[model samples]
Target: MDDEQQDGRAVRVERDTMGEVEVPADRYWGAQTQRSLEHFDIGRDTFVWGRPVVRGLGLLKKAAAQANHDLDLLPDEIADAVVQAADEVARGELDDHFPLVVFQTGSGTQSNMNTNEVVANRAVEILGGELGSKDPVHPNDHVNRSQSSNDTFPTAVHVAVALELAERLQPAVDGLVLALEAKAEEFADVVKVGRTHLQDATPVTLGQEVGAWSGQLREAWGDVRHAGDRVLQLAIGGTAVGTGLNAPADFGPTVARHLADETGLAFRQADNLFVQLAAHDGLVAVSSSLRTLAGGLMKLANDVRWLASGPRTGIGELRIPENEPGSSIMPGKVNPTQSEAMTMVVTRVFGNDATVGFAGTQGNFQLNVFTPVMAHGVLESIRLLADACRSFTEHCVVGLEADTVRIAEHLEDDLMLVTALAPHIGYDKAAAIAKQAHRDGSTLREAALASGDVTDEDYDRWVDPAAMTRPG
Candidate 1:
């Protein structure tokens, strides 16, 4: 290591396998991270190191160190220092030290090295050694012992995705389901005209409509949960390729056990280390489930906005929260802003699903080269869906109210109510009655009474809107 000055600031020269490079004196990242920054200054999509991926990496490194110590592969002092340093990284205390972008190596080698360097340097500091000295602990031999980026990065991704789905996205979906269920019960007696092909069909209680939306979300939540479960199998021991190589046979299972204990998740070693390293099918499944959820959320939001279309001129069957001005030019206008936001989020999730699916197909041979972007896409989808669900539930679904007067008007005027007459009067005569009412602009009762096809008492009994909402 060389101590140097650059632009009147203190700098340190760190050497990797390639050569020596200058890293900022204050940052913990070393030569490999600096090389990645200089070469792949590609995008603004840097990993937010304080989020799940970095936290997962930190937790994984700590587990790896503990496993190595338990296996007698690492000394106790080095393992203790590394564990403490890795814990700090896991808790996001060292977030600023990890400054790599997500678009680096496809295997995320640079990011894995970044973690190793930060932990090793910090551990060295803990042992009263100079930074970048490689004195007490080597980034590879000690900190990254018995692991490779090919295996470690994928394992970290699985841990991150599983934890995120369980801790954030699933809870948000549950909250939305509960909110819609409450609305369903609240509007149990509200009768409204139903539409098919954008034309009036028959009467239905608002409760039924809201309950259907809740059912869709509950199903989607289950799909996401099941998909998340598939990623709990990790690829830790698969070292460089599918082969265990330098790592012991029990290394992967040992690390996974430690991780499970730390995170309270059911993490385990993958059944096939080769498949875990080569294909991202598990993450693809998770993304597909998220896409399904996005579709459901889109339908629910569109339905809400359509039902709450207008207080004066449109459907006007439901009222939503008036959070802010809907338009800059129109006064007293309140648009379904939450619905619009949710639909936009759905579109993004759809795009992410496409990215993840395509990335999953790019596994060349021994290892997938698209792990970093795949991780980014899946994690972004989860975060966006979780946040949008919570926002929609709080700002829109919880505040929904039925416009009873408008619903009554629509229900009373709908000509499809004539369907209740079809079984009483022959279908042909019922059709004629609806056609006559539409042509003459008369009520169904007036049209039927004039036609001598039905009696007033029969019309009253057959066309009860509340009774029409249920089976006879």
Candidate 2:
């Protein structure tokens, strides 16, 4: 290694198979990382798009060290130092050391090298060695022992996706489900007009409508959980391709076991390493599930906003929390801003799902070359959905109220109530009554009474809005 000064700061020359390159002396990354930084100035997205990827890489490297040591393939002192440095990376203590953009090599080799160099350099520092010196612990020989970017990058993607689903998205969805369930129970008795094709159809309790939203969310949550389960299979130990070329037979399983212990997640080696390396079906499944969830959320948000349309002119049956002004010019106007934000998040998730699906199909030959972008898409979807659910629950769903006066007005005014009179009177007579009421702007009760097709007592007993909410 050579030393020099540039930009008034110390710099060091680091060498790879290609040649020597200048890296900032202050940063822990080495030649490969510097090369990537100089070459792939493609996007603003770094490991920061999902910090969990950095943590996943750290956990993977630390576990690899432990596995290598247990196999007697690494020295105890070297492994111990690597583990310590890797733990710092896992805990986000050295996030600045990883600066590679997500748009690097399709196999994410640059990111893998980025992690290895940071850990190796930090391990060197721990061993009282100079930063650029590959003295006691070489990045490839020890820090990334028994692993390849092809396998380890996908493994890191799995780890990151699984942990984010379990630790962040699941809890947020549960909170939203609970909030909807509580509202359903609270509004159980508030009768309102049901709509079909945006036109009044029949009467249904506000509780039933909200309960349907909860049920849809519950189903979506189950799908997401099931998809997340598929991500527990890691692709480590498949060194260069799917054959486990340079790694020991048990290397993948050992690394997976260590990762499980470290993360408290049910990580296991893939039954078929070839499939794991060549395709990202698990991530695609997770992304599809997220898309399904986005659909559900979109429907729920749209329904909420529609129900809470206006206090005077619109549906006005449901009153949502007025957290902010709806417009810049219209004073005292509050919109369903949370619902709008959630719908926007749903749209983004849809786009991410499409990207993930298309990316999943790009696996050529023995390995998928679209690992980094796939990781980014799936992880971004998870993050956005989780945050949107939490915000929607806190700002909108929890504070939801029923406008009983408006609900009753709509329920009473709806001419579809003439249906109950059909079974007693006749379909043709009931239709006539409904049409007459709509044309003359009269109440169904008045039209039916005036038609002389039903008695006042029978009309009162037949067109009960509360009773219409449930099956007879």
Candidate 3:
């Protein structure tokens, strides 16, 4: 620790802000990173930036340091020490002690510095030295040796997002798929009219409609998983903007092997180091797939909510959970809050896609200018979507019940369902009779009875909407 006199006071050991204005002592981070926190404060959202991404990145560095040490690329002592410190931080041995400033530095230089300071301090302490002592395994010289901001920043982003998708997104999607499938089975016996442009004209099983949503969700889950698979494309080998400017040629493959061993993931060197260094398109690609999944989920959730509207007022078939009083001015008024929350999360995911799109465009010749924002945005989107899916499934979809009386009432009054009777009465006669039935405010069976279009026994035998929409 260094001490100095400033403003007639004794100042000991300059405080690092990672990027913001420096502190005399007992501080970390720097001026620019501090300035960023205040300058780019967006708005109070239910979902904000989180510590997991940063923590995951720290783990990545530790793991990387170990790999590099084992590869003989860096000093074994430093690598082992860095890995040890990182392991402590990872296992929550040092809670909130990994002092990363934030995602700043155009290429996250501040965050890199933050990592350097924390690891260096921890290592110094482990080596029987004072905190912040840059000796033996210097933070940048040894711990971050053979790496650069261009590659490290994006690499960490990939690791964090990929892990999150594997650990969080997949399980939630599985839950959603099962929920939809269960609903399909529950409503399988109830046949109803199918509509085009809200104008019903044919028969359909309520189960079949719900089953379609299940198919859509299952496909979306596959897309999400495919996108995650791409995230395993790590950039650790392509150092310093892909020129390998300061990196050893043999270092790349060794580090790759180490990463594969450490992560139990299929990590490998980028075939084209140039592309990996100068751009963050891999993350953009993965995030875009997530956005697509979010879009499908939004449609499915809203449709379920609408189809499950009411026991007396709306579509009134599926009954969502009564979590809270939906209306302040009315009694027994429950709303689709779970669906609304899912919709809101989808909106944010879509919005993050726009930012990812913008960030992609901003990647100039050798680097992208907006790394921190892009990574932060995408990470937040993934987390929110996963959380929303879990909440919606457990609180809303899983507990949903079917209202029998409502389905029966809708089936009895639906004149559009005359398409079921078409095979017996002929199409033109069925259409004419359905219009007449609606005008006369009678069941299609009664209207057909009055119009002499069909006999009661024939209506029963041929006009069964339940059988027409059923799979033969």
Instruction: Show where candidate 3 strays beyond 4 Å.
Output: 3-12, 15-49, 92-103
**For model 3, how does the per-residue alpha-carbon lDDT over 357-453 read when each residue is reduced to its tens digit?**
7887787787776877777777888789889989988998788877777777777777876776777768899888988878877788888888787
- What global local distance difference test value does model 3 have? 0.72
Q: Of models 2 and 3, which has the larger lDDT?
A: 2
All candidates: TM-score: 0.98, 0.98, 0.89
lDDT of 1 by residue, 1-472 (tens): 5778999988999988888899999888899989998999988577763278888889999999999999999999999999999999989999888888889889999999999999999999999999999879999999999999999999998988998988898899999999999999999999889999989988899999999999999998889888888999999999988799999998999999999999999999998999999998999999999999999999999999999997798898989999999899999999999999999999999998999999999998898999999999999999999999999999999999999999989888999999999999889999999999999999988998988989999999888888889887
- Ten residues in sequence with the least summed lDDT for candidate 2: 42-51
Per-residue lDDT over 214-299 for candidate 2, one digit per residue giving the tens place of the 0 to 100 score: 99999998999999999999999887889999999989999999999998999999999999999999999999999999999999
State which candidate has the highest lDDT.
2
- TM-score ranking from best to worst? 2, 1, 3
Q: Could you report the Cα RMSD, in angstroms, for every candidate shown?
A: 1.1, 1.0, 3.4
Task: Give the TM-score comparing model 1 with the true structure, all chains together.
Answer: 0.98
